[model samples]
Target: MHWLVLIISGVFEAVWATALGKSEGFSRLGPSIIFAVTVIISMGGLAFAMRELPTGTAYAVWVGIGASGAVAYSMMTGAEAASIAKIVCIIAIVAGVVGLKLAS
Candidate 1:
């Protein structure tokens, strides 16, 4: 259950990150609101998960999910350049996150 929460928190990290980018420095009301709300939820989930998971591993997983999701979204939306290297690196991050989970 803690792992589930942690994974969800990581997903929200991506949600907030994407919303923040769309917020245009908090100028846009909708995206800004989305960013604020998701950030809180994401952090809350992270904190909850931290009660059971090791801090270092949890943080790494959280960051890995967020970064991987954000990059994938950017590429899919044409907001960022896509390349094989970028995809491979994102996969590596995900693999590392999974490896950590398995090792733990």
Candidate 2:
């Protein structure tokens, strides 16, 4: 359950990141609100998961998920240009996340 919450929180991290970019320094009402809410959820989940998980491992996994997810979302939406290198990097991040999970 903690792992599940952590993963969900990581996804929310990506959502909040994207919303933050769209928020334009909080000038946009909708995206700003989305960012605000999602960030809190993400942080709360992270804090909760930290109770049972190693801090380093949890943080790395969370960041790995968020970074890869944000980039993938951007690429899929055509907000960011896609390249073989980018795809490979995302794959690597995923692999690392999986590796961390396995190690744990």
Candidate 3:
């Protein structure tokens, strides 16, 4: 159950990160609200999951999931370039996150 929550929080991390970019430094209201709300929710979920998981494992997994997911979304939307190197790194991030999960 805690793992599930952690994963979901990781997804929210991507959401808040993407929204933060879209927020344009808070000049945009909609995405700014999204960023604010999701930031709280994501952090809250992370805090909750931390109660049941190791600090290092939980933090690393959270960051990995968020970073890779946001980068993938940008690549897919053409907001960021989709180069071979970038793809490889994204895969690496995902692999690391999964490895952490499995190790846990």
Candidate 4:
């Protein structure tokens, strides 16, 4: 399904984003490879999903997933602060993603 592909792409987007940060200007080898691969796969999946899903809706969803997942991963990995405000913002992003999907 297109939706499934979109969500999977979003997940890959998150992975690539986090990996990019860890890559440290591409100084790191492993994470850099992961970043490149996931980024390509994520974009490819997004393009495929766009064939059926509206561009705006799919983009918003993909961004929402990447943002939320990256923040969560950073917090869990102790790479970023985990504050109440951050959590609230992530929740808001989720709400917006859901609203867009429902309204579409």
The clash count of every prediction, one per candidate, is 0, 0, 0, 0
Q: Where does model 3 exceed 4 Å of error?
A: none
List, residue by residue over 1-104, the lDDT tens digit for candidate 2: 88999999999999999999999999999999999999999999999999999999999999999999999999999999999999999999999999999999
- Higher-ranked by TM-score: 1 or 4: 1
Q: How much lDDT does each candidate structure score?
A: 0.97, 0.97, 0.94, 0.95
lDDT, candidate 2, equals: 0.97
lDDT of 1 by residue, 1-104 (tens): 99999999999999999999999999999999999999999999999999999999999999999999999999999999999999999999999999999999
lDDT of 3 at 32: 97
lDDT of 4 at 89: 98
Worst 10 residues of 2 by lDDT: 1-10
Model 3 clash pairs are: none
| Deviation of model 3 at 70, angstroms | 0.4
Candidate 1 TM-score versus the reference: 0.98
What value of lDDT does candidate 3 attain over all alpha carbons? 0.94
- The TM-score obtained by model 2 is 0.99
- Model 3, span 1-104: residue lDDT tens: 88888888999999999999999999999999999999998999999999999999999999999999899999999999899999999899989988998998
Best of the two (2, 4) by TM-score: 2
